[model samples]
Target: METSATVAFVVYALLFGWRLVDAVEGSASVAVLAGGIVAGYLVADLVSGLAHWVGDRFFDETTPLVGQNFIAPFRRHHVAPREMVEHGLVELVGNTAILALPPMALAHHSLRPDSLPLLFSGGLLLSSLAGAVCTNLIHRWAHMPRPPGPARWLQGRGLILSPERHARHHRRPFDRAYCITTGWLNAPMDRLGVWKAVERWLGRAARQDPR
Candidate 1:
């Protein structure tokens, strides 16, 4: 499954790249593409935070569907934060690659010549998936004793999640700094009490549930 997902991810990524280049050459403005890339990064960060929050706060490792594969990893990471560093590339990115396939496929098929809007949207979707595909690797880097020089540089500049920023999430309560993609949204989201509010709502909903 991992190997297949990785191969599919590579194929879709290449297709998206080709379409993106074609769009640029045809009619898409550089500014629009740049905006889409920026928007994609922010959206990916937001998504990472929401998924991280859900993984950390809800469902046990024994629950159905997401239990063993998803929830367990998040739970284990809290106990053994450095374990992610030992994961291979396929292990790190395969699941996200699987999740990314549909949108990537759609973007590849939907992108057209001289259509700035489609180009912009395609750029946003593909870039966001690209960010998503890199999330686990980025998270692993944060836990590494010393990541690659380029990663270290990005982390230092706050262009990506850093060890220092991610450390707060592993601390007791484990309720803050959930945006593991770039850490750009962590501060604002934490300050706004977004996760806390969601937790409160979920708690109330659970209490009211008949199940």
Candidate 2:
């Protein structure tokens, strides 16, 4: 896992450099790239919330790959929220790196300098990939009683998950505030009743007759 994470990091470092130089020399405007990055960050927030909700509610520790890799840890977290702080960097970032490798590779091969399509598509994917990779670190900070001064500052500014905001999820039933990266989408997602809607839909599907 550590090796895979290391390889993934190297790949991203190289790809970022390549894209940076290409965007500078190629036709894609900086404005377009910026838009793509913002969109990507938002998308990552939504994805993080969805994934967290599913892991928390839909499965158990006995379930297979997802069970062991995702659901089990979530279950453990409900009992010991601080466990995340003990997690090694490899555990925090490795699996995400594996998931990110493909999209980063695709962008590297398919995108070109100055192209709006490249900026919109490739930039969105790469930036969102970055956000996803940062999820664990942000979550750890949320759990800390007193993270570093800089981290506290960022959390206070709402640039990252704040301890007070994340505490709601740690409350009994563990249902809301699932987005841990930046915690930007939790309120909107909760207000829209998105996760409840998904649960009802899935419950209905599970009850359908197989015959």
Candidate 3:
């Protein structure tokens, strides 16, 4: 009944914490995962912009108007750029914690109890970092415009480990590929067609803008 604020805060806190964990995991590895996340954070605007532009450009007569309605309003109004940046990290932590559950459970239950704890713990942490990094990059990329603030410093590798790309997803939600750091897997993701549309548009734009 009275769970509104409590629920919201809890959700916010989890996102904030999780992103921190994601940032940490990303730091440990510097390849695709790390780069993706960093890309998400540093150039969220570009990534999301490309994603959105692609989505629009490739949209056919039946561009799945169903889901867009729910997402559009939320993107335009509810998602606060300030809160998401501050709280996004917490959500990342929560996500990693959730990811750790299977590994953690196995570690807790298995007889002889192998290195599940170490492996899964590492996995959980890394998952957060990877997700956050990817999420930030892919997210910021999708949103079109960058989030405002001195917090933009987060995009810089020196200060924040996570990517800024995540901002775009918040600002302009879409069904194509919602994740921040993992664009490669977008095709494998559930909405293969949508992701393809986004890619097609992006390809067209690249040919034209050459930016």
Candidate 4:
């Protein structure tokens, strides 16, 4: 698992680098591409939050296959906030990269970098993958006793999830502040009651509490 995860991480990293280079080289408007990248990052933030919220609120860690691999980790995470930091890098990256790698590979093969729609979507997809792939590292930084200088700088600038911001998630019930990447979308998503609406709809549809 570790080996495969490392290989996947490396492959995706190279692809992302190539995508950026292609976008910059092929783009007629660097400013527009840059905006796309920013938009992509924001999309990632929202996706991460939505995933986190679902994992935290929806299922138990014993629901068949997903229970062990996916649901369990979130449960463990809420219990031991720094537990993932102790895990090997391969485990970290592999678990997070699964959802991201395939779409990225498809984008690389299918999208033309010069086309505006393709370029923006490609940028958004890759940036979202970056945010997702690095989620564990960013979350760990939020718990580190003494995070490295660069991490501290990034956290301070709100470029990554900071310790102060993440601490709120660890509090009782663990309901709010679900986004663990850049956390740029937490406020708006929560204010809009998006997760609540989803839960309510799912419960009504199924005639059982989904939360």
Candidate 5:
């Protein structure tokens, strides 16, 4: 399943790239395409943060559907951060690739050769999915003692997640710097106490639940 998903993801990504180029050559606005790509990255970063926050806060590793697969690895990462570094590429990206497929397929199908709006929106969605696919690998690199040179360069420039930025999340309370994609939203989100606020709201709602 993982291998299949990974192959599908690569194929879809290549297809999207080919279609995007054709759209551009067909007179789609370069400015709109650029804006979509930028927005996609930002949205992907925000999503990574939210998923990190939720996985860290709410569910345990035994919670049925997401238990062993999602929640367990997330919980274990805090105890054994380097374990992620040891994961195979397919192990690291397979689940995210599976998660990203439906939307990616929809966007691919919706993309029209002559429609600039479809091109822009499809570009945004596809780029966001691409970022999602890369998120785990990027996170793994941040935990590595000596990541590849390209990753190191990107980390230094703050273009992707960095060990220095991610370290704070590993500190006691394990609460800040949840944005592990580019780590761009971490500071502002932490300063605003967004996760804390959400936790508090969930706490209140849970207490009032009849279940």
Candidate 6:
């Protein structure tokens, strides 16, 4: 089944249909529906963070429950626990707000119907999926080392991802690149992607002018 947020966002968008109700004929379901989406996505992320926080705080497991072996290859780059907490906190806040902003804006002037369930459910489903997909993509990129040459150009746009830009997060291990996903997710997003791109671009520059 589609996650609650994914289903919810789609349904919320379709809320334009609620106009059929005579009582809310002029209402814009966008706000109410989107708000539900925002809330749903935020809740999922909150849950995930809570899990991570609890795991880190209580389990005393140095390795994650999942991806222990996969991430092992990158052990040379294991970040400090303090860094994880700081970066993770920034991610928690930024990601939650991103989901919340769209619907919150729409709600200010929206006209929703008496039956808010459709929009509510739809919003939750769509938003939930958004967090999952976006996070997954970013995490994937962060794990991979920078690709060579023209692929270097990707670093410029790679902020949409997580792992690729994460190297700087590893190097500094204290400040910046807090979020692996988007610039909006954290200033570190822009910093990480841009720095990686420039690093690659400089490599290309040196190769072309090698004296």
Candidate with top TM-score is 5
Give one clash count per candidate, in the order shown: 0, 4, 46, 0, 0, 27
Q: Can you write out model 5's per-residue Cα lDDT over 124-192, one digit (the tens) per residue?
A: 887789988999999999999999999999999998999999998898767788889998999999999
Per-residue lDDT over 1-211 for candidate 3, one digit per residue giving the tens place of the 0 to 100 score: 2233334434443554344345343333424344433443434323433444343333333337723632332233233444334345444234333433443334234422123333334334334433442444334333434644543554443243233333333333444333344344333442556554645666754232111
Give the per-residue lDDT digits (tens) of candidate 1, residues 1-97.
9779878888988888777776675333777877788899889999999888778777778879988988889878887888989999999998999
Compared with the true structure, all predictions reach lDDT values of 0.82, 0.76, 0.38, 0.75, 0.83, 0.42
Which residue runs does candidate 5 get wrong by more than 4 Å? Answer: 25-28, 204-211
Candidate 3 yields a Cα-based lDDT of 0.38
Clashing pairs in 5: none
**If candidate 4 were superposed on the true structure by all CA atoms, what would the RMSD be?**
2.9
Model 4 over residues 58-101: C-alpha lDDT tens digits?
A: 66767787888877788788777787778766677777666666
Tens digit of lDDT per residue, candidate 6, span 63-160? Answer: 47533532322232243323332243234234444454456335423644456675565566545545543453344444545533333454456524
Q: What lDDT score goes with residue 125 in model 1?
A: 84
Rank by TM-score, descending?
5, 1, 4, 2, 6, 3
Local distance difference test, candidate 5: 0.83
Superposed Cα deviation of residue 160, candidate 5 (Å) = 1.1
Work out the TM-score per prediction. 0.90, 0.86, 0.29, 0.86, 0.91, 0.36
RMSD of each: 3.5, 4.4, 10.9, 2.9, 3.7, 14.4
How close to the true structure is residue 114 of candidate 1, measured as C-alpha lDDT? 61
Clashing residue pairs for model 1 = none
Least lDDT summed over 10 consecutive residues: which range in candidate 3? 111-120
Which has the higher TM-score value, candidate number 3 or candidate number 6?
Answer: 6
